[model samples]
Each structure stands twice: as C-alpha cells, then as structure tokens.
Target: MKDLYYIFDPLCGWCYGAGPAVTALAEHAGVRLHLLPSGLFAGEGARPMNAEFAAYAWSNDQRIERLTGQPFSERYRSEVLTNHQQMFDSGPATFALTAVALTEPLREVEALKALQHARYVDAVDITDIDSLQAILGRLCLTGAAARLARPDAQLEEANIRRIGQARQLMQQLGARGVPSFVLQVNGQSRLLPSSAAFSDPHGFLEQVLAA
Candidate 1:
C-alpha cells in the first residue's frame, strides 16, 4: 500500500485550495491518504483578524481561487474576515479533526472537507468549539463532536505527535509551506512535487504508483 501524507493547516488558504485534489487522491486505490495537520496557524502563530491581515488574506485567496477554482465567498469576506472577535486559531479545528480520527477514522477527511467549507464558504468561525461541534453534528458526526468536547490527554498527545511528525517530514523534505505531499510506496518515501497536486492529481497518483 502507498501512504500519501498531505501536511496542512486548517486555516491556510492554500491548503483549502488543494482540497479537491486531495479528495481525488484520497479516493485512489492502493493509497492510504493521511491528513497531517501541521498546526502552523495555532499557538503563537495565531493572530487577531485585523483589517490589514484580512485584506492580505483576501488577496491571496483570490489567487488560490484562480489557481484551483475553489471558493472564497462574500460571507467569508464580510462575516469572518471583518469580525474582530475571533482569533485565528487552528487548535480547535485541529482537535475537532483529531476527534473525528479517534471516533471514526474513515470520516476524518470528510470532517476536514466540512471544516474548510464552513470556514471558506459558509463564513463560520471554525476556531470556536461550539461552531465546529454544531457543524460536525449537522454532518451526522455527533460522535466526533462528543469526543471533541471531552478531549483527554491521549488526544492531546495524538495531536502533538501528528504535528511533530509532519514537521519532521517538512524539515527532511526542505518544504517551507503547507499543502505539501509526501508519497510513500514500498516502504520508501519521497516528496511529491507541489505542481502534481494542483495540475494533475490523478496523473500524480499514477506517477507515484509507477514509482
């Protein structure tokens, strides 16, 4: 089996852009797709969504939309970006995804897709536990939400390990950014070119299989 790791941050605009390609890769046979949250936007990296950051994010979002045909909505622009009340933390969403993995591993990616859509499309504050839980509940993932509500030390350790491993991989590959891919086949792992993800995900899988 091939293991493909997509190192991402929940609040990253580029990661959201790579969503469709990642989904396609997830569906490929003989490939075990692992969603590795880097937590890059969590902890000390998080910031308040000020007007300056909002404008900058919107500019970058437009580029992502052009490149990947993903969405950046008016609601997201007005409601999410303009709201000074919300801090840009990836921790809650990361935990929520971790919760999904703990309760229903197969639905982890499904949870992530919903997370992205809620943030980028529906303009929801994904950094809040209540909002994330509500969205997960609507997706029929109340079990995951329940797990999220009562996260134990084990879940925290799991989140740390995931981010740590992903950071190590990024360091090894000299990749500076999120939305990076590492394809592992036959016990050997190598970095997949970033272009393969955006330009041709299926062909990228074929290339990895052939490798």
Candidate 2:
C-alpha cells in the first residue's frame, strides 16, 4: 500500500486551512495517511505574548484566511488569542489526538477532523481535559480518560517514533511546513506541491499516481 505522511499539529491554522485538500487526497487517492503530531508550541508552559508577537501572528493569520477562506472565528480572536493568559499550546490537543489513535486506530482521520472542527468552529478549548473528554464522548469513544492517562506502552513508543519519522520525511521531501504531502510509490518517495497551496490537490494526486 502507498503511504502519504501528513505531519501536522491540530492547532495549526495552516493545517486547518488545508483540511479540505487533505480530506480530498485521503478519500480519492486510496492512500494511507499517517497523521504525525509534531507537538508544535508544546512542551513549554504557557508563555506571555508581547504585543509584537501578537500583531505578527494576527497579521499572518489574515493572510492565511485570505488564501484559504477558512473561518477564524471572532470568538477565537477575542476569547483565545487576545487574552495573554491563555497559551497557544497545541500539546494537549496533540496528546488527545494520540489518545484517540490509540483507542480507535481505525477512526484516526475522523477523530482529527472532529477535533479540528471543535477547536476552529465550536470555539471549544481543546487543551482542557474536560473538553477533550467531551469530544471523545461525541465520537462514541469510551475509556478516553484511561487512554489519555495511560496510553499503551508500545503505542506511546510508536507515537514518539512517528514524530521523528515525520521530521525525517519533511527533510526528505524538502517540505518546509505542516500540511505538506509526500507520496511513496514502488518504494520511491515524491514530493507534492513543492510549496504549500490550497489549490491543485488533483494535480498532486496525478503526480503521485504517475510516480
């Protein structure tokens, strides 16, 4: 089976923008997508954001919005980003994603979609354990707390390995960002997009199939 590794963080705005493209590639290409949680903005505790940093991020977000037409809700702007107290960490969401993968391997993609929707659309605080548990319940995934607290040893190991693998894949494919695509066919890997773009998903699939 051909593999397409998608290295991304759940809270990444670019990944949110590329959602439709990722879904299209997954559904139409018959490729197995390995979702790697990069844990961007993770590990460090919440840090204070200066005015300069906030302005830069918001400006960049505007560009992303213009390019992809993905909604960045006013609530996210006013409630989450504006408040200097709340950290923009993606670790908790990434960990919850890992938990979902461990508990329901088959539903990983759907779980990711649901989680992203919950964050970007519903304005839910994905970093909160209670919110994550609520999402798990909605997905009909049981024992999420146990899974979150004590992930399978082997699965935890694999999750760590997957992060390393994703970084290596990014280097190999010369991809500079999350939401990049790489297709492996007949034991050879080919880079798609060369750069990130919301358009031309079909072109990417064509290149993959031809390769």
Best by lDDT: 1
* Tens digit of per-residue lDDT, candidate 1, span 1-211: 7788989999999888878778877887877889889989998878888999999999999998887889999999999999988998899999899888878888888889999999999999999999999989999998888878888898899899888998999999888889888887677768887776666667777766676
Residue 34's lDDT within candidate 2 is 70
Superposed model 1: Cα runs more than 4 Å off? none
- Tens digits of per-residue lDDT for model 2, 1-100: 5687777888777887777767766776467877887665666633555666667767777777787777777776665666676567777777777777
* Candidate 1 displacement at residue 117 in angstroms: 0.5
Q: Give, for candidate 2, the lowest lDDT window spanning 10 residues.
A: 194-203
Quote the lDDT for 104 in model 2: 74
* CA displacement after TM-score superposition, residue 181 of candidate 2 (Å): 1.3
The most accurate candidate by TM-score is 1
User: Backbone clashes per model, in order?
Assistant: 0, 0
